[model samples]
Target: MRRLVDRLRYLGPAAGFLSLLRLTAAAWAGDAPKGEVMKHRFETSRIFPGTVRDYWVYVPSQYDPARPACLYVNQDGIQYDAPAVFDRLIAEKAMPVTIGVFVMPGRVEAPSPGALDRFNRSYEYDGLGDGYARFLLEELLPVVETLRTADGRPIRLSKDGNDRAIGGSSSGAACAFTAAWERPDSFRRVFSAIGTYVGLRGANAYPTLVRKVEPKPLRIFLQDGSNDLNIFGGDWWMANQEMERALAFAGYEVHHAWGAGGHDHRHADVVFPDAMRWLWKDWPAPVKAGAGSPQLQAILIPGEDWQLVGDGYRFTEGPAVTAAGEVFFNDPGAGKSYRIGPDGEPAVFLEDSSGADGQAFGPDGRLVSALAKTGQVVARDVSGSQPPRILAEGFPPNDLVVRHDGGVYVTSPAADPREPGKVWYIGPSGGKRVVDSGLRFPNGVTLSPDQSLLYVADTRSHWVYSYQVQPDGGLAHKQKYFHLHAPDTADDAGADGLRADREGRVYVATRMGIQVCDQAGRVNAIIPTPNGKVSNLTFGGPAFDVLHATCGDRVYRRRVRARGANAYDAPIKPAPPRL
Candidate 1:
């Protein structure tokens, strides 16, 4: 009877909306054992200040406080009659003994009667980044943990991501996916119904991102209908199809159901129970990340995660790798530089680094560093046998690179935000000049594999400019070549240190992680650091096949498949890029 009613919901908006209540009431009529629904309000949120919202906690009868139970989080309060569904599923052992958290979108009250209240549904649920996830993990979940159910029973949830799941409909569905996408370490399962995976809040990029970024350990169940929304935002049905295809192309564990109904929860209500069965099949067994697209697989090695090389630094950056596999990085705030050699242990290399912000190995077997505070670029032998030689002075260089011909290029960010930053080139004949100046704040500079092109990251924008390297090492034909993705929290990409691989791929360390762009300049993959902060990275290891990144207070390294194409080495033209 419930399924028949839901199937007929597409008669019209007024009729469909009316039919939904019947489904809800029917959910409450089942003879299945039930759980307690505790309603609560959250008025304090630092992430989305002044916003207040209500949330409900569904504590299953089978949940035991002694053992932490699995968790399921849903947005836009409760839908699909989830509590009754959970009651039946738990009793039948079709799913784990899980606790469900149903939350409404936030609303900020107007200061006075004349102003309208600020609604946070679209702002919170449709935007990309870790904001919503942080709100849940750092704010809401903690507050819920403090609550006590009847009979003094406590609400204890499992901390393992494998034990957690998130789901919702429409924009809320997009929110659920974003939360899991940004923090796969905290939630590994997603259920998206009539998802707003369209241009709303940049979510349309997910189809492309799902194929480019390193795959996360996630399993998803998507539900949508052919007759769903097709308005200014986008076609929900087509977007869902793209998502399903993208997931399959990337080898993700994905399941879906198609129907002829319109944009509503009707179709989902009918398939909700079966979706849960498929989602939680093989309970306690972990969901796994995938062998990504060939592009990503060509760079990342399976079973190899980022390993901490060193920590306890004030701020680390400017990773430089020597030919013999030694890696060196600087702590600018601490005014120190360190080296990791054959023993794989970091040791102090230079106690007085003169505020080195970026460094690279020179063609002459020397280390060239850009001293940000001292306004100098200096070269020192890796063996520490000679005094440092000043390559250039009187310019605040944030990062620099040493070319194979003994030439040097430095990025000098303008002290004033109103003025554009400048790129400095120091010739092999010992002359320095400003090559070009236009980027908002040029921070990281590198050369192409063939050494015929230069790439510079604008720290204040989403562009990584590319220029043709002229005969005299001057730059020409500048264009915003590499387009990067910025975090929702920031105005720009915050693009920093840059590197190129032997395969002609450019890696730009940004706030969103390592945005890897192919020769044609489109981002092909995003590799995030373990700490979600990567200032700079360089290919190192004995074969130049390991990636080392300086991630603010910690340095991490991961073995990969590509060899570093150093500006200091002989130029070898890479194969043409895939268009």
Candidate 2:
């Protein structure tokens, strides 16, 4: 009933909407056991704020309160006769004892009949990002748990994301995938049929992002036909195929069924039972992340993940590791520096850091920093005992890199829009010279492993400029070398800080994640932060194999296959690229 009403929002009056429903017969057959369905209306949402919607709770007759039931959530209020299908599947022992929750998109009531009520379906379903996912986990799911069975059995939903599955059709399908994609720890299995993966919003970028970013543990089944919607937004048929290919390329456990139907639920209705069977095939077994592209495989080590090291900082930045393997990061907003000890616990290293933004460790064991608030560059001892030696000042520096010969290159982006950003090179004698200027926003300066080249991230563009570093502390042969990926919702890559590995690979901290590029400047892989916001990074640990990143208010570290190259150390030529 909620499904029919949701479709009527775009279909005008109820008399006409009822005509479309008559085209299809009731989807269930007598072979499937009749399961009980209860209708529900939801009016409270702190996430959506003042929105109302309806939902349903389908409880299989085989459900016993002895164990918590596995959860299956569907969008757009239950198509495909899911209650009956669950009845047959649970009775046959094909799937586990599950509770299904089908929810409708929220809508805010209008002031009057003539005024248009704001419809949230397209906004909630089509847009990208974590808002919709939060709505499900923080809002809807909690309401579903409050529901009691007809026999007063207390409802319990499994806490594990692996014990959950979600599915939907059309725009609802996109919403379902977004929920799983954003919170894979909460929903592991996805069933998307006739998904609006095209440019209805930023969802069109999913195929590309799925290929570039690290793979997550998800088993997805897609169903679409060739004759689906080819409207102004995008071609549904081609978009679905692209999604399948991207998932396969990323090494996900993906399955697809192609047919000759339209955008309606005709094809999905026919194959949903089979899809459910495959989605829950090997119950009680965990789904593992795939090693999809060789690029991701080259850098990321198996069985290692991003580990939380520190949290509760005002805003963490400037991750630098010492030769002894101690990881240090600064919370410039709080004017403090923290050190991650061998036991992975963070302790305050400096109580007042002058609000540093970028940092690197010198060969003499001092920490060099680009101080943003004081408009100064300074070096200080790792401990809080000594005073900082001022290197340079009077410029608003965003990031900086120190070289083997004690030379420093700093990026000072234009504080005012009317001015051009500049890169200042400080020679060994502490003489400051403007090596380059007129960039939109230069940031995250670093040197190549051999010290013969320099790289700078231009925050206003998708390109990272590379330059030949001359012996006299000058730069030449400047060109846009590394091409980074940006989000569709943003104009720039948001590249913040950069570092080079011993293999000459560069990692740029961007809004999308950390894009790892080879010597030839081609992005090979993207490693995302645990919270989806990455700023500055450096390599740490005894072997320099641990990549530590300053992500917003927290700091995280992940052990990778590659080791880091320190600019302050002796220059070592890395192996040549594969052209």
Candidate 3:
């Protein structure tokens, strides 16, 4: 009877919306078994202050309280008689025995009758942040762990992400995705039906973000219909399609089914059973993401492999590209710097590099470096003239960036222990002054294309700080910071090197991968390294679009849509009308 009502509600929606609703109804009904409904409510003071969420747990007869069972989480409360379906599927051995937890969004009750309670649906379900995921893993799941099955089997849940799955519809669908995306190590399988991947609560930015981030080990199943909502937020069907396209572009293990129905759960019901099977098909074997996207493939040559550029060094830092697309990096520990020419050959660029850890090229055809051992900024012309000329003296410079105006800004990490970092400006007249201070382990620094802003990466924290560049070579409003996150990793969010493209995409070399942030300071995508730790990166090639990364002993390259902020952007004068 409930199934029939669900079908009727789905059919009432627009033609395009019916397919999704119908499929959901069928999927749920086909898998559900005949079972009794059970309900339980509990309150805990351990969660966010004054916030209480009502959660429903479904237990099937096939669940043996004598042993632990797999777990599934459904956002937006429980639906489709999940317990019955689990019982049937487990009894027939069609699916693994699992305990289902359906949870409702939290609400903060009003202090008085005149005031209304603050419902957290949109805040918890639609937002593209990790607060909700944190709430679940740290608070909700821990509380659920205290409970036991009817047979007294201590409900021991698997800590492995592969053993966990999350599913939902509409806004709940978005919540499910945000959870898995933010914490892929917690949930690896996702089932989304008629997902609210639109503008509501910043969900619309997901498509673009998906394409930019490094691929994670996640398998997603998406379903939506043409007749879905076409309201102020966005067209649900269109958003889902865009998500599918972005996932494919990023080489994610994504599958989708489109129908001619509307925004309800009917179509999802029909597909739910199959979606479950697909999501959990290989269980412990694990599902792997493809070899990145086409753009990534074009840049990374699979057969070429990562050859040892050089080794036996204390620390390798700073990579810069020349006009010929050759790369030169510093081996600070060995007090030497090597260059990799376009022909993939390594040669000594400078044996006495003055203990250089960070290097870049200035527009005047000279290489600029941060000489940590000498506490100075130096510039050396490639013509192999005399030794490097001191551009500015008296500061423990860590990383340096050269502006088009011939000015230089170098980060000093040893300036103060409490603050530990400061950006110093070196005027074209050879005068030096402190631009800004109070940064935590500032390691990498770069300038925007127009030189309007400077980006600094803090290797000790998970934040990338940005500062506006004043015309007089000073920094302003330096508090703006962007987050760089990875799946349950250590504080290695430490971004070591920074670079930017014409489109304002900032790439920070980080521990888990290269975290890409857009103009708005949001993490758009992540580019993982074949090896985990990446110390630095730079853009090369004739057009300045090929990205080269220095990870431990290996170097990797990739192509991107945006062009690098080359020091020299002017057209070269024709060579004396040769003759």
Candidate 4:
């Protein structure tokens, strides 16, 4: 009884509130311009799988068949009196002629009468990844374009991200932000009300990630209440504030509206009209990515984005640079090797690469490789004057590094999951020994700037193990030093190739992107690749300041501020890490 009275007091006579939402646009504008509303059902979601959902599309009366209309997507099948608000705004020339999409959460039907249906609201909305974004871009939005208006006018939405906006309340609001965060190229504006930015589905990491990742080109308006929910997931009010603070800290263009109400949509509904104006104030002007944290600014140069160096390969990996700064990479699936010189053009260097997965230059000016198919580590001169010399021939090394002192270390994953991975060291004089063993899947291997420590990426877990390099070419005191972030759908970080810079920052190729960590073993920044997949990276180009990444079937390069620390060169002790 008290709850009902509090709600009545807060919302004030439900009938009047309903009347306020249903009022004709003629109250504000001279005429009430109406739009065509159509409802449909969608069940073919490969991303969410076994989920069926209903959605509605609103085509404004002013829509033209030739010009593509702007877009607004709302969750929970539309709220905040959007149709009337859109009519008033469009009639007054405040917002653009936009096509609106209102969708509901998905549900999977139960096979038996005794079982309850599976609801996908929390799974799709509260989680973080490219899944929901891909669903909208690949599945839902595409199906929307196939529909038509009442008069048979085709619905055409602008492909430009600047012309799109997404909004919702509660979990839907979180989904709106996640979609834009993952793909700024698709949706760049967000309207979040009472967002569930808590630990319901790993959304608690957003505050930390926003402060660490390079900022995307997005403009967001957040709305929450002072008396929101304080459940086991997290404090809604505090999480929204943390999000606002983190966005501001990373230099994002964001706005917020706080109320004294609880976890309901009443406050958000009252402020809905104004939020639209603020979100679309500057029409046609593109939202630009902001200057990121100091850590990101140090590595990513201004106006230097990822540039494609090569493509259409089977699979590119094992990028290494010669002393003169020429870059070389192998396509093991194609059984070929390629080289890129100062001209920035790639050419076939070796006709046959012996199916090598990782390679590095040695102090002796010889290029050494870890051949996966033949289970051998071989070294050869670029001149091809001498045949390849086998350094080791038993374990199949996934990655290897050669130090300035002629020390070679390689990571070899076990043949079975029941066994542990091994790290091997081949001395300068030639015999190889198992320096260390016990990692789940020891992959990419590299040495510190001073060659005093060795780093190896354990792909089966979210850890990059570090070891003290002993004088006798053996590892000692191994520790799970560098922590990494995994995707919401995966348990491991998918850490692969790794390399250290002269500044003692380690760049790791991961599923979540390139996680750059400081010497203290803390991830300071995340730089995602063009295609969102990276296998390996190395410093190359004329000045050795260019970063070349092997991304699946493509290769990309970018100029940066930091210099790569080549293990084959003389070591220099870096400044001590900040505690």
Candidate 5:
């Protein structure tokens, strides 16, 4: 009886307070102009595989089929009385003639009635990656466009990301943000309420990742109460605050509203009308990507971004820059090599490149290639006029580096699992011999700026081996020098390529991105690729300041603050790194 009385004491005031707020909000929410709502069932999805979902489309009465309507997508089949709000806003000319898409999460039917149905809400919403974004851009929106009104007017959504907005509450809110974050070219404005930004999935990494990568053009609004969920995943209130702080720290256009309400939608519902006003204010102006953290700002030049230099390749690797500031990369899958000249255009340098995996420019201006398919080391002229000069044969090399004196060091990892990987040395006279053996999977190789040390990237481990170069063209005193950062989703560092700068810092291309490590092997900064996968990088351009990265199927280049060290040039001792 005492416990019951205590519950009543709390419930009584809370129920009355919420009811009063709802009564006050109902005045405008009901009096607002109305929009036509059409419902549809969608059963086909290759992305979610064997799932069905229901969706609703809201078209404002003022919408004209002559022009594409601005878009708004709300997950979880819509909340916050969005249709009425959109009706009022459109009627008042506060927002454009917008159409809203309310989509439910996908579900798979069970074999029997007693069996549990498979739910994809958490997988599609809480989980990270670009899968859901692709579904929306490639599947959902295209399907939405096929719909027509009762009068047979086709629904056309604005193709511009600036005119699109997405919002939701709880897990739906996370899904909305994920859609915008992954495909900023599709959705630019986000409105989140009581978002699931905690550890329910990989969303826990957003706060950390947002500060590291280049910012995307997005305007976001966040809302959470102090009394939100504090369960096993994480504290909801704190997570939203952390996300807000991270967005601000990374220079994002973000706003927030805190409240004393608990983990319910009542407060969010009350504030929905005003939130819409702020989110869609100053329409038609594109959202700009802000300058990220100071560390990122230090390396990335102003007004410079990753520009696409080449595409249509199966897999690109072996990015090498020459003294003339031209970039050469190999497409091992296509068995072709391409060169990007000073004009930033890709030209076919070599066809049937003997399936080269890594390449470097030799002291004589010839391109030295590590031929993996034919098990040969060859050097070819830049113009593709002469046949390749086979320097060595019978050993399949993964990556190689050439010294100014014409000595070459190559990494040859065992194809089979049982054998150990080996590093080879070929003297200027072409005498090939094993320099060292026993690395797990030796992949990318490079020399220090002074040519006194050699760095070898072990793909199967999170370590980069550093070796003192001996006078006899062999390695001595090898140490696991640079420790790399691996992604949480994978076991290995996936370190593929490495390059050295004039400041003695090594830029390692891993699953994470180009991790710039100091001389002491401490990672000072991580520059992620736009696609989150980078195989190799090289410094090119007129001043050797542009870092060209060979990502999957494409080549991207960006101007950086540091300059690359040329292996074919005379060695110069660099200044000591900061401790």
Candidate 6:
């Protein structure tokens, strides 16, 4: 018995090592075509100044200069004889004629010989941001465009995301995914191997984010092993499985392969050739996403989806539409407000607008707002006249909702050390009274369709508190705080804004998409945004059925079955401006 147990332990390690050798042999045997491996050393004059990198390109033999070829990007340098596989696949008519670019991480040489080389692998590969993607789209690809194929055919890459793919392994795998996740317009299909979707550098958030974010048009293939790393960061195998499960739950077009091996390129080596086939399974035909989860279908229209209205903003928030169906939003970080006119173009509305957080139209035809800088509830007439009149002051206001009776309730989040966050009601006469207290990070205040209850979203606690509205404009019977559900791995839902439709469904903009709660305080459905970390949302368009979401720097909208509440039901046209 003792001998058998000893033999089992040795067998495990011995088999693992042997498997690694086999994978390495396979990789070397599948070397790319000699002329296909074209290397270009260039300096990026625009971004990451004083940085240089080696960009490797592989143009398939069938590529024609007259017709643009599909593009594929692999981070962390080249891998697994990609050129050879691409040549074979294109010849076999399995994938479109594609141009593959393998890029090495940036490096800064040490000032002196004694110091070590300033390797930027971890910095560029591990951080959670769009810097790496920008390096590829803005710097690397353009340089590749100047090169020609061995046949002297000029290289022209397709700009459509449907014709492009990006992939990598380990930390590079996370970087590849971050690129597509940050800028889906550049690359859509993804191939990840032994992916570092773990806690090394906030990569573990992907699983939770997948479910919370509105599903992108990306098609992903994940490869991992049962015997992968189990260390301080996290279990790579478990994280990979979690990501797959979340993707499945969110209705993304995702496929994955699980194996019994450790953390390395060995499993990926054996799988890369097959992964390429699957990543490009469909050629010019686009990949379609599956219907969202049942929880999501309730709020989101089955056929309606997010459409990009505009881009290039410092920080977009507080999306609201005017009576003419034109949208308006704030770029608080830039200290400017913009309006999307009927022509679909953005123009400045207000500059230096007191750092507005939330904006809504009141029944009286005035723009009601929660100004963070002034900590006041103010109302600005449409005429854009003298300084706005303050409804109430002396509290750090975050969001506000106007009741049918003309009173306003604002959320005061805990910012200063001396004050705890509270919900206050401001009477029509500008009198203030505290309604509720002792909640966590109150934000996104709204009312029920019947005007009998108020909903307050506690951003940090994953719960939306419901309060009964009394006749005198006070809250009571504060029971049934609906808990916002999310995967255990994610950070607290960043529930920042709230809106409601005529059907009495309350839409709470959360980190994991918008949680839709019915009148009974039950989560009837979820409406995901195209991107994660949506800051706020509002219903717009002619019928008020279009949902506009403020996701970081981008703004997206989708049509829905429910119609938004008419905040300004009695439209009283603003008095004509005096000359």
lDDT of 5 at 518: 79
How well is each residue in 1-579 modelled by candidate 2, as lDDT tens digits? 555444333322222333344322233235556666889998888878878999999988777778989999999998987887788778778799999999999999997889978879998899887788898888888888888888887678897999999999999999999989888999999999999999988889899889988998999999888779999999999999999999999999998888777799866766677788889999979877899688888899998999988788889888888878788888999999888888889998878877888888877788889998899999888665788889899889888888888889999999786788999998877978899998889988899999999999998889999999998989999999999998755888999899999999999999989999999999888998889989989999899999999899888889999999999899999999988
Instruction: Write candidate 1's Cα lDDT for 1-579 as tens digits.
Output: 655655555433323344455445545667667899999999999999999999999999888899998999999999988998899888889899999999999999999999999999999999998999999999999898988788678999999999999999999999999999998889999999899999888899899889988899999999888889999989999999999999999989998877777788888876677678788999799999989898888899999999999999999999999877789999999999999878778899888888998889888889999998789998898777898999889989899998999899999988989998899999987879999998899999999999999999998999999999999989999999999988767999999999999999999999988999999999888998989899999998889999999999999999998899988999989999998
For candidate 6, give the lDDT of residue 376: 81
Q: TM-score of every model?
A: 0.94, 0.89, 0.62, 0.94, 0.86, 0.72
Better of 2 and 3 by TM-score: 2
Compared with the true structure, what per-residue lDDT tens digits does model 4 show for residues 1-579?
343344333333322454344332334454758988999999999998999999999999999979999999998887987887888788777789999999999999999999999999998899888898899899999999999987999989998899999999999999999999988888999999999999898989999999988889999998888889999999999999999999998889988877677898877776676678778888888888889999899899878999999999999999999998999999999999999966898999988888988999999889999999899999999989999899988988889999998889999999998999999999987999999999999998899999999999999999999999999998999999999998887999999999999989999999988999999999999999989899999999767899999999999999999899999999988878877
Winner by lDDT: 1
- RMSD to the true structure for each prediction, in A, is 3.7, 6.2, 9.1, 3.8, 4.9, 8.9
lDDT of 5 by residue, 216-237 (tens): 8999998788889999999999
Q: What is the per-residue lDDT of model 3 for residues 206-307, given as tens digits with 9 covering 90 to 100? A: 887677665667889998888999999998999999999989888888888777778877777666665777787867678675556554553444444333
The lDDT ranking, best first, is 1, 4, 2, 5, 6, 3
- What lDDT score belongs to each candidate, Candidate 1 first? 0.90, 0.87, 0.75, 0.89, 0.86, 0.76
Residue 573 in model 4: shift from native, Å?
Answer: 1.6
Give per-residue CA lDDT, model 6, range 63-149, as digits (tens). 778899899899877886687767666766768888999988877767787997677787788767688888888878887898887
Candidate 5 — which residues are off by over 4 angstroms? 1-31, 380-391, 404-406, 417-420, 427-440, 450-453, 460-493, 510-515, 518-533, 570-579
lDDT of 2 at 187: 93
Model 4 deviation from native, Cα RMSD in Å: 3.8
Q: Which residue runs of candidate 6 sit more than 4 Å off their true CA positions?
A: 1-35, 42-52, 149-152, 307-399, 411-423, 428-430, 434-443, 448-496, 501-536, 540-544, 548-557, 563-579
